[model samples]
Target: MAFEKGGENAYDVVIIGAGISGINFGYRLQERNPDLSYIILDGRHEMGGTWSLFQYPGIRSDSDLYTFGFPWRPWTEETSIAGGPLILNYLKESAQMYGIDKKILFHHQVNAANYSSEHKTWSFDVTANKTEKKTFRSKFVLLCTGYYDYHEPLKTVIPGIDDFKGKVIHPQFWPKDLDYANKNVVIVGSGATSVTVVPAMSRTASHVTMLQRSPSYILSTPSEDALERFIRRWFPVYYQHKLIRWKWIAVPFLLVTFCQYFPSLGKKMFRSATEPQLPPTVSYSPNFTPDYNPFEQRVCFCPDADFYRALRSGKASVETGVIEKVTADSVKLTSGKELHPDIIVTATGLKVRVGGGIDVSVDGKPYNVPEKYVWKGVMLQDLPNAAFVIGYVDASWTLGADATAQMICRMLNQMKKEGVDEIIPRLSDKEKNTMKDAPLLRLKSTYVKKGKDVLPKAADRGQWQARSYYWKDYLLAHYGDIKSSIEWNRS
Candidate 1:
C-alpha cells in the first residue's frame, strides 16, 4: 500500500523514533491495519537508532543476528554475529524494502505529548530541525524511543579524572578522528562495550587494559554457525529461515532458564567453558568470575573467543580493583598498584530514559510516569490510546519489540471494529495500592538499578506485570484477553 502524505499536522498513529522498534512497528502497522494513517517521527537525521549512534571500535551485536533480525526478514549472513555497519545496512534495507522509510519524518523531535480525554486525541509539541516548533495530532501514540537517554550517558565519578592529562573518551560518542595506534589504552568497566573495545583496540594499541570494579560473566561463542549452514544446505528455503531463527532463540532461552533455575550449576558450566580460554597467568576467579550468577546481569558474548585471543596474544589484560585516584598519566588502584596509559575510555553503561524523555500530560495535567503502571508490558495504566515498546533483556531485543507491535496492532484493530475511539488500561485505586511493585527490568546491572525511578511501575502478576519471554508474550498477544483491565469509549 502506497502511503500518500496525509495532513502535515494529524495522523491516526504517531510512532516516535525511526529505530528498530519504530521500523518494525511501522511494517506491522501497515501489514495489519492498512487503513490507518501513521507517520514515524525521529529526532535524529538517520535511522538505525543505537547502531547509527555508536561508532566505537568493534561495535557489534552481543546477540546473534538470526534472532535479532526482523521476523518477516531473516538474517542470511554467514556470520551470526554482525558489526554495526552491517546491522545498520540491514535495518536501512528492511525499512526501504517495506516502504517504512518513506513514512518517516527525520529531524522531528517530540518534546511533549498531551492527551485530551474529551477528544481522545494526542497533541504532540514537536521541534523540527531543533528550531521550528510544530504540533501533530493523532488518535494513538507509539513510543518507540527505546529505553536509554541518547544525549547523556551514565556518569561514574572517577576520582581525579579531571586531572588526567591523557585523552579521555566515552564509548557512547567515540571520536571519528581519534587515533590510539601504538598507545596504551585503559577501558573503565567490564560490560559488553568494554569487552568489545578491548579486543578491537588491542590490535592497534601498544597495550590495552580492561579496568573493572568487579568481574562479570563472559562466555565465548562461534562467530559463524556451522549447524545453521548445514540446515540451510539441507532444508527447504521456506523453512530454513524459521528453523535458523528459532534455533538461535530457543538455545538462548533454554540457557537463560537453566541459569535462572540452577545458578550454581550454571556458574560451574560457565566457569568450565571459560577456564580453557583464559591465559595461564590470569585465573578464572579474580578476573573472569562474577560474584553474581549468570544472566543476573547480561552475559557478554565474545565471538570466536576474540577477547580471550587478545589476552593470549599479550596485547590485552584485565585489572580488577577500585580506583583510588587518577594521576596525570596513570590510574592508581586501591590495591596500591598504578598503570600508565595514553588514553582512558569510560565504558560504564547507559542512562535509562523512558518515553525518549518527552514530557507527557493528560488533559492538561502532568502524567507521572514512574507512579503509573505498565499494562501487558505494552500500554501504560490509565493512559488512553497509547503504547510503548521495551525489549527483552535475556534474549534478542527484536523479539519482544515484535511481540509488542503485534499486540498493539491487534488492539487497534479491535478498537476500530468495536467503534471505540479510546482504550485505556484502567486499574482501581485499591488494586494499585494493594499490588506489590516489581522492577520492569529484571537485571542486577548498575544502570538498571540506578534508572528504576524513571520507568513506570509494574506488578508481580496480572496484566500489570512485565513479561519478558517472547513465546509467552507472543501467545498472549495473539490470543489472550485484549479487554482485560481495559476501558473503552466512543468519544
Candidate 2:
C-alpha cells in the first residue's frame, strides 16, 4: 500500500528507515508477495538515510559500488568508490524505480513498538516531526535503521576541548557555511571519516593535520575497478554487471580469509599498498602502520590515493600522539608537541542504537534488546513477527542485508501456507545462557566497543551465529528450514 499522510495504520508489514536496507526490503518483500500491504517510514525530511545525513567533505562509500549495490539493481556508475552525492542519487533512483518512493512517509519517526500476543500484530507509536503522535499497526515490523544513532555521533569527552577557540565540527553535523578555506584544519580520529576529510579539506585549506591516538590500516584503491570497466565495455550490460558483482564479492572473501589465516602476510600486503604512496621523509611505523593485526578494526579505504597524495604534496600531514590538552590556538600533545589550527573536525566513530532506539515491549513487558540472542542475524529471540536488517562487518554491508531480506521473505511465505499468525525464534535456557556469555559484535572498532552492551548477541549454534560469507548466507536463506528454530503460533 502506498503511504499517505494520516492514512490508516494497518498493514501486513511496516519497514522502518528509507536507507539502503529499507528500500531493498520494501522492493524484495513486495516482489515476493505482491498483495502484502507495507509502508516505508523515515524520520528525515526526505529519502536517503546515511547518504542524506552526512554532508561532510569527501564523504564516500568505503566499499565498492558493485558489491554494495542491490543484486536486483546493477550499479552502472563508473567509479567503484562513489561520492556521497552520487550514492544519494543511486538511492533516490532505486526508490523511484522500485515503486518504493510512493510507499514512503517522510518526517515520521517510530517512537515505540509493542507486540500483542492475543492480537498477533505490532502496534507502533510514532511522532511526526517531533510532534503529533500517531499509531500504526502491522503484522510484522522490519527494522532497517542501519544500527547507528542519527541524532548524535559517538562523541567522547576530551579534556580541555571547551577551551579550543576554533570551530569544532563533527562529520555528522557538518556546517554548510563554515569557512575552512585558507585555514589550518586539524581532524582527530583515524577511521574512515578522518581519512576522507584530510584529503578533501587539504585541497582548499592552508594546511590539514590528521591527529590520531592510534593508526588504522588504510588502503588506497582506484576510483574505478579495472575488471568492471573492461566487462562494461566488452560484454552486455546484464552479463557485465552480474559478473563484476560476483568478482567484487569474491575479492572480500579472499581478503578476509587471508587476513584470518596468515596475519603477517596480510599485514605486509596492506602496508605495501600505502608505503609507495608516502614520501621518503615520512616514516610508516608510528603514524601509518597499526600495531594490531589486519581486519582487527575496519580497513579504511581512500580513493585514488587522495590522502597519500595530499601528504606528498605537502598540503596535509599526520600526527600520532595522545592529546594532553586543547588550548585556544593549538592542541597540546602528550609528546610535548602542539598543533595550531583554525578548525578542528572530530572524526570519532558513530553511536549504534539497536531497533532504532525505539522502546519495544512484548506482552506488556519492556524488552531488553541486548539481552536477546539473534537468530540468523535477522530476528531477535522471542520477538514475534520482527527482524532487523543488520549487515556483515567483513564484506559489503548490502550482501548480508540482501541475504536477510530473502530469508524474511521465505519465512513470511511459509507462515502464510501454514496459517501461522505469530512466529518467534525462541532459545532454551541453556542457549540463552550461552549467548549471555558471548559478545554481541566481534569487531574491535571503537564504535562497536562503545555500543556492544546494547546490541544483540550472536549464539554459537544453529542459525544464531552471524555468518559473514554471502554464499553460505545465500544457501541458508534459500533452503534453510525456518520452523526448526522458530515457534509458530496460530490465531
Candidate 3:
C-alpha cells in the first residue's frame, strides 16, 4: 500500500543503488515492514549492478558463496566460487522471489541529496536516461550505492603507454568483442583483479604476464566440498542457510576476532595451516602482511583446480617490477627488459566511491565524511534521517549489510516508540579521536585505497574489537555490545 499521489510526497525511505547490498536491504525492509513505502533506485539499467557491468571473462566472487551469497538464500550450485552471471542471476531470482523487484527503478541515478533539518526528510534529484529528472522526498534516505564508482586506469603514469599499438583495457570495462585467443597479454597489478584474470586468460591466450610492483597477500581455498553438497541436498532452504551461515561465516568471524586481539596466536595458527596452502614460490613476507588480519583488507581467492592448472600450464607467469614505458608493441620493464605484448590488460584494481556519488551535507555545508565518524559503518552519525548500506572488504559483504538491516529495524522501532524526530550521534572528543586513530581497512596506495577526503572511510569499529565476520557483526548490531562506543537516544 502507498500514500495518495499529490503535492505531498513522503516515502518511508529512498534506497540508492540496486546491487547485491542494496537489493538485500530493500528485501529486508519490506520483510520487516510490509507497509513501508520505499524505492530502490540505481543508475544502471539492470538489477545486478556490479555483476552486470563487470562482464569481463572469468569474473567470479572471491568469497565463498555459501555465506557470501545471501542470508535468506543459499547457493544451490556445486561450484564453490559463483561467477558473475550466476551471481547476477541469483540476485535477480532472489529479488523476484521476495517481490523486491517492484520497488526497483532502473536507469534512475541519484545525483544529489539534501537532508532537511526542519522537515526531517531527505530531498533528492534523480536523473534517468540523461535528460529526465525527477524529485522525491522521503522520511529516511538509505544510501545503498555500493562503494564508489569504478577506479579508472591507475595514476601510475606508465611511460610510453600511448605508444603501445595494441589494446589496453581495464577489467571493469572490458568490451565483449575483445579477444585474447592466441594473443600475448601483459596484465598490470597483482591485486584480486589480476589474480582472477591470470587463470582465465591462460586458458586461451598464447601467454599471460602478471606485472606487479609488490606482491599482494594472496591465498587459495577450495570452492566446494563433499560435506557442503550433502548438507545442501538434505536440508531445507532455511536450514541450509543457517548451517551455511554459521559454518562458513561464524567460524571465520570468530577466528578473525581472535586474531585481531591476539595477533601472535592468530598468526601462528594461520601460518601453520593457511600458509601451507600457498605454492612454494609464493611469498609471505611481512611487507605483504595486511595492516589487519588475513581476511581484513580483502578476501584472497582460492580457485579450486583451475588456478593451479593455469599455473602449471606455463601460459601464466608473473613479473615483479615497475613498467618504465610502453611501446606500441613492447613494454619496457623497470628491470630493463623489453617484453613484447599483443594485448595489455591494466587490471590495476579499483578505488572506493562513498555513498554511490550521493552528496552528503551537515550544518548547511559539504560534509567531511571521514571526520564525522560512523554508526556501525552503515548509518551516518552527523547526518539526519539517513543510513547507508556498505559491505565488509574482508568477510562477506552481506554480513555487514545484514547487520545494517537489523540495526535499522531497531532504530525504526525506537523511533516509532520514542517519537524521535531527530538522531545525531555525538562522540566525545576523545572517543572520536580513538576512532580516527584506528581504521578497519587501510591501504596506502592512492589507486587501491580510498582517498580520505572525497570517498571517505567507514568510521567503524576497530576490526579487532569488532570483527567484520558475520556472526560477531550480527551480535554487535543485534545486541548492541558496542553501546559504550555509540551515542543513541530519543531526539
| Pairs in steric clash, model 3 | 80-223, 148-353, 163-328, 164-327, 164-328, 165-328, 221-302
RMSD of each: 2.0, 2.4, 3.9
Clashes of 3: 7
TM-score, one value per model = 0.98, 0.96, 0.87
Number of clashes recorded per candidate: 0, 0, 7
After superposition, candidate 1 runs with Cα above 4 Å error: 1-6
Cα lDDT tens digits, model 1, 43-83, are: 99999999999999999998999989999988978788899
Q: Candidate 2: where are CA atoms >4 Å away?
A: 1-7, 433-436
* Model 1, residue pairs in steric clash: none
Ordered from best to worst TM-score, the candidate numbers read: 1, 2, 3
lDDT of 3 by residue, 148-228 (tens): 574443445678888888998888889899988999998887777777888888889998888777765566666666666
lDDT of 1 at 184: 97
What TM-score does candidate 1 get on C-alpha atoms?
0.98
The residue-level lDDT of candidate 3 at 20 comes to 85
Candidates sorted by lDDT, best first: 1, 2, 3
